[model samples]
Target: MLTSANLLLWAVLQLALLILLQEAFAWWIIAIYALLLLYSATAVLQKRSAASLKLANIVAALLTLALLLNMRQAGVLHFMLQILLLSAILRLFAMRHRHEARQLVWVQYFLIASCFILHQDMLLALVIMLLFGANCYSHYKLFAPAGARLNFTLTGRAVLIILPLWLGMFLLFPRLPPFWQIPNAKIASTGLSDSLDPGSIEQLVQDDRLAFRAEFSGTLPERQQLYWRSYLYEHFDGRTWQVHPQRRQQAVAPPTTAADVATASYRIIAEANQQRNLFALGMPYSSSQGVKIGSGGLIVADKVVSQRFSYSIESALAPLPLQSEREREMNLQLAAGNPKTSEFAAALRQQHNDTEQFIAALAAFFNQQDFYYSLTPPPLGRDSIDQFLFQTRSGFCGHYASATAVLLRHAGIPARVVGGYLGGDWHPQQGYLAVRQREAHAWVEYYSQGHWQHFDPTAAVAPERILQSLDMSLSDDERDMLIPFWQRSSVLQLLSLQLMHLDYYWSVWVLGFDDRSQQDLWRTLRQHIRLIAYSAVAIVLLLLAGMGLWLLHRRRLSKPLPAKQLLLKALKPALKNKAPAQSVSACLNELAKRYPNHAAMLQQLVQYYELAVYAGQPQAEHSLKRLLQQHKSSLAALNRAIKNT
Candidate 1:
């Protein structure tokens, strides 16, 4: 019976944790839990007899196998969860002993430990509290009588007392890293990617998913200028752009000039995306811990970040003149086969004297011509740049930037596609800028004079996109508006920003504090060794004192009698000792002869005491006091009376 009860409890715990975590195997666990409930009901119908319960138990085990099959896609941790759940269900249905029950109890604990891997949110912590309380209640009920109506109340108090101790242990416990790495369940990837494909930023625009968080050391850049750079794509395949692996370059030292060093400084707290690209401002010169400088003056991770990561960077947004011939050549290289664009560029070069004049002329034409910024564009065929530039002047940032970069390259000017966010919404509460996926944009960076000069040709056609972002540039009826006005209203926007801050803390201080954090924590602890030692001694002393008090209180409460009742008990032994002879008649006769003055009182009291004693209600108080007062004479009389009788 105990075994069955324990198993039932264990199964319930597993079901609860699974539901709370919202694991991928939710349906399987639900089905198994239902099966167990059905089997339990059937056993109850058979009056809980062991032999009749076998069929129900067997069916439950089979359902467990079904559960495993259902959770095949959930990976190993989920598989273990299924196995343990099924074992608990089987144990409960076939339970016949206490040992099995104890095993089930440990199984429940193991299930809880598994929850730490699945989720570590605050809500899960509350659920664990309830499970722990239930465990204690079950143990209490095993020994407590059914009539003890205060059992729940007492159990609640015990749980309250136990909670702090358990928390203390939890907090002080040395958390070990996972024994072996478990296969990670796929979560959403955030931030930018190396390849820019269709539908890449489609769903991401609708996502409120956080990409990364930043904390500035000084004044922050305006939302319109919060262009966090990740990667630069130089290869274009007409419809999509890609970063070539072979062409990947490292960062070079910027020219040391007064104006060239102008930049903003800040720190970033980036979330894990299992990608190597790290976002910084315009041009970063230095980076914080764990970040590596890449060939393109970008920060690359030593490994794919699988946890929340933080880094600081120094960036310069100031313009610098192009100097290196190799850098310029690399930027200008485009796949050599578009005759129309090559011819158009040659014609434009004939009209302009220099590279600077060519760039200015192109920007002037885009501004004065029938160019219009539209999200939807007509399909471009083989000569995409030629079609976009000469015919369909109506295009989004992608079209404008791609055409501009190709034109500059054809004109013998070094240019590449710069991929990053164009603008952001400033969040007051978070003190940071929020750049969503829709803010994703591309522009041209061409080597001009002596350094790379950022040139946004889209600015000529859609100036508002550069000033307020694509989101704010579009009105309610506009096709390019990602968020409705009501959603982006200041009130709603403030609430979202606050939520982001909370998410930031949860990602950093809570969820992100892992093995490396533990090492830092231990280092800090070692520095304050005296404080830790004192706290340890104080806790031990407090525990010892509390135990002593509890023991004393228990010893006192176990006995019901008071001091008065104890005095009556003491008098019985004294009175029995005073009897001179074993014979009752002789003791009485001797008492009458030797102490005649007290004989009447003695006889009357003894008779009354005997009657009351036989009736099981001794008039203990008055009789006990009278016997004490006459003890000396009565004893002498009783000695003589014993011999005479």
Candidate 2:
């Protein structure tokens, strides 16, 4: 029968695997794994025998086939995870002897370590640590089968002993790149895509997940200046706006702009979005390693952002570069639909001949009209711009930006919709700006006065969105629809903000500690090398002195007591008269019998000797010394009397 310890080990193993691989596999696969775990736990609780070898092999074959069939969909990373977890479960199911269980525990250690590849959040790290402790306990109980329990004191002592070594290796060791590239799992990407449908950004508005964080080197920019551009949508199909094919194919090195004294310098710590596009403010002039400037001044990563990524950038809050003739032609091209809206745009253009005047007219039309900014907008028809402009007049940032871009194009101006995030929550105390999914916004960039100018028709209708946040601009009903119920209360909202702050610190200090950080640490150590050397020498000397003192004290404790030494010395005369093999008790007995008048005192001496030496009584030694000292002359006379007799 499997002991309770073995059952606990298996339980923790299954839980760790589930938490690690739940996002990698499909629901059905997870269901199968969970069901198998439940069945095994039930059997172990009821003290059922282990499955036969043949039955275990059959089940393993089935699981292997399932995993192989799902490999393509799960990708290489998740496929490996599934294979590891399946093997562990099968081993546990067939575990009978101590050796097999030992092998299973070792496999579990690898599985737990693999969890870091998928998750690196502080809370998840703590959970992984707990799982490690549980596995260690299980391993301990394997050998110590007599009612094994967790010994926190011993565990703590072991940790204390190993902590310095672990820290030294972590800090002083070289931070090398991975020997092999790990494949990213097939996970869904978050944040903005290259295309902008009418309701795409509206869907994002309901999701409050973090997108990225920006820490500035100097003072923070105005809330309205925080337009984080990621992608430019130039191709409009009357309903959806997407990037032109030429833009993707024609990625050239960004022209270096002279850095102004007031240039904004900052670092962005972006969450995994599984996409190549990155976010930046205004026009990025220069970026750190592993990132490049792509077409239209957009930032692109060297690889897919499959993990948390940090990069520094210097950007100039200036007008974008002039568009090429091909870009102008592509942005000005409008689809065949939206004819009514086209006529309206032409009439408005006829009133204002200048491009700036025409753009102002369009903004005034949106602000003056009975247009509503909402998360839940009505669906559009074949011509989404027409329906949103003339009929419905109610939509989100995507609708307004789309209609405005199309209107500018109809009026002979080259215009495109820019998809990215807008205002962020600036945390002054934390020294970073947190941009979430709800801030996902779209605006228009129109070519005017020899350069591309940033414009937001949505800002004309909802100025609060540019000045504050999405929640501030939204109504109570819209806010309710965007935010979850738990965040409605002030207490819960503050608690959530606090947790986010903590996660930000974890991302910066722990996950963000890379090669550059280590180099900086080494540089600092070198600068203070002399002081460190002196401190080390002083510490060594102090330790040696302490050890010498401890050894001397132990030697003193191991030696004979002073009272016993005195007793041995006083009995030398009497012992010389007795036979060599005779014990001190026999010599004392002879003296007591001969000195009958002083027999009580001699007898007392014998009792004291027996109690102090044989019985190991400390107080009896003091009594013996007192009696011997009080009757020193009498004892000597008794000794002489015994010698004469």
Candidate 3:
């Protein structure tokens, strides 16, 4: 009996932590918790005295309080969470009464809510269903009469009855925006940023967590043609790249490339990343009301993407023809540093006559050089491009892109770095592209011949990374990454993909169900809205009536037997010479005399029956079962004696 309670509580805590602790708790804290949990389990199994547990609980409480108060590494919220978890552990070990056990039930609800708050994924939703079932059973066992088994059959029937009501309420509830601004809970920022520091792009590659998923409407573009332009960066301050300051002011309809628009309009389901940076294939033509398209044909949100967001996007496959005086000047602007980088650009300009030829020659230069594409590049000095070009000659996409933009500007050409995701693993089986943070890439877009064309210098060095997924584009050394690294299991990769496909649709239909979708649904059912509403109201009324009837039926079935009925059944066997319903003491004497060998058991049963029937002991369920068991044995002895006579 205690085993079920212990396992259920522990399982709830473990599952909650599995979801919450992904971006929260430290390793040492988890290790310490594991040890304490082991000890608590041992104490319960050993059946330690209550007094011993009280002393241990006091020490544990003091230690936990001291740890939280003195710990500077964790925030107040995290500390509160830690304290709550510790108290739960302590309470689990020291459960002594029905009151304390009831307290644990409320705590389980809190843990479930905490997990939901942290993870809004479809997988969590499915797991929550199982958790609900377990909780129902645990609750039944906790408060049920001692020695009585939980009736799962009744529980299942109750769930089946309630499920329809739950579904009705969910469908009928108005989809309203949040009443209060939800806090950006403890997850770190992920993927691309407007500003690019020395190792900013490098940090993104280390985390291969899903950034967003794309599902297209038509045929997909070629690998090289799939240039996902997030937003344009127009300013460079010697080392770092910043977004064009007047970008918001320059919000205008971007020029179309040639006459051909993108046939492959896609919908992107982006994960929340504590930032407003949203992504698409190229230029986003269609989006939700909350989103805005920048002048450079990139998506921008009014608020931080605090949850999973879905937006439709239409992008042209060809190069975007950006033609404007402001864009030309902004993209061409260069910082007053890196004299050697300027000199090299001047030499390249002197070699080529035409602007297009100079760009092509420059693109060729990266391939002709000894530059190496690497994840682990050496640190740079003051002039980053000068060092990368002359000495180190090794860096990722950000390095090559940044250096080329600076070099292009020095040569009197308009160029800027375009930051966004590149290639995604096209899961043919699922028909959705899984784009991870490792696909976070930066490349140069130089304006020439009245058009802005995309050029990835990283492609000249590491073409495979542009052509294939991150995992397939890695060296043996990068493939074996384990410490603070991302990995995909080759054995279960296909299985994982199929599971994610299911989860994605589930999230879209369930978690991503919003006001717009509700309105669309409402439009379809407008003619029958009154009929549906009436039917729903009628169903709810019927359900309430049914539940009231069930309660009354259960009461009738399990109601305790009255004193007269109970006494008559107990005394019937020994009443051969007496009245049909003999008094308790008279029935007891006859039974004890007939079964003298079983006198002790008969006396115990008689005392319990008197306490329950005459004294009216409310908590007599356990005593009743014991009395009935002993009474059956005494009746057996009487029968055996009668047979012998």
User: Each model's C-alpha lDDT?
Assistant: 0.66, 0.85, 0.73
Clash list (residue pairs), candidate 1: 249-295, 250-295, 251-295, 321-450, 321-451, 322-450, 322-451, 323-450, 590-637, 590-641
Per-model TM-score, in order, reads 0.64, 0.87, 0.70
Clashing pairs in 3: none
Task: Please give the ranking of all candidate structures by TM-score, highest first, separated by commas.
Answer: 2, 3, 1
| Candidate 3 displacement at residue 183 in angstroms | 2.2
Which ranges in model 3 have alpha carbons more than 4 Å from their true place? Answer: 1-42, 49-95, 197-203, 244-260, 316-328, 449-451, 467-490, 527-645
| Global local distance difference test of model 2 | 0.85
Query: How well is each residue in 13-70 modelled by candidate 2, as lDDT tens digits?
Result: 6766786769888898888788777767777888886677788899889888988899
| 628 Cα displacement, candidate 1 (Å) | 13
Q: Write the per-residue lDDT of candidate 1 for residues 1-645, one digit (tens) a residue.
A: 343454456546655755754554566466756666566646645557433357746776686667667554666666677676666656666656666666766676676666666554445555787887676556554555654544567668987999999866544567876588766554335667777643344344545455666767677776545766777777766657788665565345553335645578776766567687877776677776688666556678776775667777877765545445666676767775667878878899999968788888889989999997765567777777777778876677767777888888888887887776666655556666555566667777888667777788977887887876675445455532556666667899777656666766666666656566667877998999999999999999999999999999999887633323333343333335554545443444455566677677556655645444444455653564566565756555544554564
Q: Give the best candidate by lDDT.
A: 2
**Error of model 1, residue 619, in angstroms:** 30
Query: Of 1 and 2, which scores higher on TM-score?
Result: 2
Report the alpha-carbon TM-score of model 1 versus the true structure: 0.64
Give, for candidate 3, the lowest lDDT window spanning 10 residues. 482-491
